[model samples]
Target: MATDSLPSAFTLFESIQPGPVYRIPSLLYLNSHQVFLAFAEKRTSSSDVDAKILVLRRGKFQDGSVEWDETVELSTAVKSGYRSMNPCPVYERLKQVVYLFFNCVEDGVNECSQVLWGRNAARLCYVTSQDAGLTWGQVTDLTESVIGEQVQHWGTFSVSPGHGIQRACGTLIVPAYAYIIRYRCCLIPPGFFTKPRTFYLYSEDGGERWSVGEPLSRCGTGESEMAEIAVSYGNRVLYCNARAVAGPLSCRRPSRVEAVSLEPGRFEIVHPARQLPESDSGCQGSVLSFSCPASDQFSWLLYTHPVGSGKDRWWRHCRNRTNLAVYLNRRPLEQRHWEGPWVVQSGPSGYSDLAYLDQASTFACLHECGDRQPNERIDFRLFSIDDVLRNIEQRGRGVATSLKHRQ
Candidate 1:
């Protein structure tokens, strides 16, 4: 399926959804049908509570290029005036089903107020589709059942705005985060939000049923994503990449948190995790595990983040959202062992999602990028695996050399 021609970037969405800003882009590749689905939250502004719609774009690969169909904007009819957000699509190859996970919060209720008032404003919901993105089922609210007794005490939480992992042994896990409101106090004004953490829900039998898993030990964990890489026969490693959002006063570092697991539901935070040498804007990034034929290896990890060079210009680089590079992790289990971060986009680029097409050795990136600013539009770019490797070889010292090694 390799082609000599590279696919031109295509605009999936702009400021046409009644406002002038779009955020949180997610991309998923469906090997079952050769379809790529892009998900995002449509908003009038950057406010978390201002999100209005959950938008999706579906397309199939033809002649080594993308052929996108019509956009499918969705709004689940909830009982209250809640806005849908964080459209995460997970494809189950065993059952051939696509489960779309999202959250909804009351229209006027923002995230901070929800935690400060000791309230749980967000609801975990999902919808299913059999024929890729052609049609979808009704929204199935899982807050009460999945979160169960903790819904009242647990503060508002939401799924990672990207793909989930279905392990090689048929376990489906969706990464999520929540602010622990039970620890909030009237005098403290939601002290628990200073240390948000990432957790996950797992389903053993496809997606028919689900249950919450143990939260990662690292605090300040924000949006998260997970992928399974098999290390040996009948044994696999679960790698989780998360955004660690820490306030200025908090001592918890805001570097990307990486965790590994041998069991199904438990994750242990690996210290000295591989930190992306990118700007410290606390932006959401994506990670994928794919087969690299040239290496004769088990699996390789691909990560995306905003890469910058200078210390004084960190804020400027973070603001411009330029140089979104892709890093490769050849050694999966080693702590902070990463290499070859080749810059894929030299211009304005921000929050991105990656999906590797195994048949073509090509990676599809759906990211927020523009001519001068990052959020002007969400564009899709395709890169061959060989191109990235070549960039790393020619550059000699890989981009991973610039990564900050924190203790």
Candidate 2:
């Protein structure tokens, strides 16, 4: 218990009144240059409609500490009535270029209207940077290029608001979800239910040419992130995990949607005997697949989310956002469950982005934390793999344990 005083998590931005508020953290680590980039949405309020601009910070490690430069606001030149949402993938090392993929929508266009009326005011837009995020190139429109004939049928679309990944074969992939509305008889679908699915956008010629992959699931999947995984026998697979929603008049249960793809965009969704629990918060969670040299395996999947259970699973806003936990699994294709949660944050926590500092043998997370609310400021927590699996023994038995009982 005495070791609890040691620092495992720290704050990057503190909350203040009548000033800037930050949310939606995105972290990118450039291993070649040992640089870290953090991106977030600088909002006027905690509401979804208050997101005005995307802000970024650049930093480098020195003596086991990272010092960040001055905060820079990444401006979007959309029309006065449009706003940018979900800034993702700030580091593109393949072509020696950086990209920020997000969606621009007209102001006052909410999700309910778009979902109910089958109308979308959103456009897939992006910007590039050659020399890091110091200067951004002109914005490009990807809505018509990636989604040509299906553009109209897409009720609305947005990125996952996290770091995107590049496949081994020189393909830039960004995870996203859109509403696929079909008009049968009235304004809403049959029995007031709607269709939503997860998809990915890929670029082959380094942002010169782009195309959209097929939907990952049939419907009801949204806000997904994809990570490339390597097997022991020199085989690679793409894994996508999405947030599952069970609305009223819907028989679907609350769970996490999981799937895999050997070919980009062509996924075989896994329907296991049991379903992964959706975080009590119901917000987006972060997952990263990385190789573990210490462990005698190819790689492991690391995930972060708020862990808890409540009586009412319909609405998550009323649930406590405490006990932000991290889980690890080696054989994702065969295993039905992951290991210990290793409770990291015991207080109000929200959407987080993680970066594996391999050389330092630690990982970093940028998340939302506060005393009474989760929107006060986005925090950066530093931890190691051993700390995550403190006293849990591994015999290939499927059970998730935790170190601290703070939750």
Candidate 3:
């Protein structure tokens, strides 16, 4: 079937604010028919920046519409003195709790870069909401528990942590990188570059406290950003990451996504692995969630920007265009190949978050779009799986009939 003919896009939701909003993250819960959008609102004053979490509930109306309502605010001035970004929340079915986790920064600087230096105390914290997202309990420090005895040097190790959801066993795994500073020629002080080890932490008691796990993988890659980790049917844990390229000023690297087995305190990489298309630039892909209806069966959906081979390769420069792709398998934890990267929506120049709702019948994405470019206003778009499947089927039939006639 022609890839372009497939239903490549859907209208999940739209921008809510007049200005541009960025760093938006979304979570969808199928059992409860609920969707949550969390992001940081940028203000002219750094202190005015606040982290906002919005809840959208699927209504019973026949029109196939959803209603969004603001539930709680984790404002910098109100809740915590630091600015919150990268909000990641996971729902615990057994405990009936939703744990909302976010990255907190004191000065509101992008920790990914080394220009701005701060304390190593930056963290990924959480707050729980029992009744969906209507109300939130007191904020809890999940970072402290994650980084138990890990020493922070020059306030770099504790910055820019990544997290994932292990839905099968209801475990929330957070991965953090250890960083070291090196002095640049012109730059006043040295910048922070990720070290070799990757640390993981999990919450078995519903985000109240996290137990630290040993490093999963180690490599010569300057900085390895943890994206997603899932337990496959074979009882192996897959770890995905974006590796940093070697160079003084080069931020590009061969994007490496690997899978590993989950042992007591460590893991090993899986072979016959799934890899990105050659078109992808060295940018790392973010795994949204692993959905499995039956035991030991699942699919891992990831979002990444497409790029070509070379240093200046820009594939379809839809600036900051976010692409959706998936890898499915029926076997146990054995390695498999990735299928999609079915493009959903692009136009805005920023990161987009996706969630599956209503038993995967509905898919929603929340991202930044506006006149301000990159970080502007936050908007959401929803699409029905049924509609997408119908389109795919129609496209498939067209391909089949054409092939038969040609023969």
TM-scores for all candidates? 0.89, 0.88, 0.68
Candidate 2, residues 89-124, lDDT tens digits: the string is 845567678788887887878776777766788888
lDDT of all predictions, in order shown? Answer: 0.76, 0.72, 0.45
Residues 214-304 of candidate 3 have per-residue lDDT tens digits of 5535432321223333454444354544333333444343334454535534556623233443222233334444454443245544443
Over the full model, what C-alpha lDDT does candidate 2 score relative to the true structure?
Answer: 0.72
Candidate scoring better on lDDT of 2 and 3: 2
lDDT of 1: 0.76
Q: TM-score winner among the candidates?
A: 1
Most lDDT-accurate candidate = 1
Q: Residue by residue across 1-407, what tens digits does model 1's lDDT show?
A: 11123336888988553564777898888887999988887788866777888888888897898888876676552325888888788878887898888888888898777766667778899888889877888889998887988766666788888888788778888888877653655577664544567888889999988988877887777788888886665567888988865456544434677888777778865543545643355777889998757643478888887764333354454454566777788777776767655777667677899998888889999988777777778989998878777765644443345453431
lDDT of model 3 at residue 145? 59
The backbone clash count of each candidate, in order, is 0, 0, 16
lDDT of 3: 0.45
TM-score of 3: 0.68
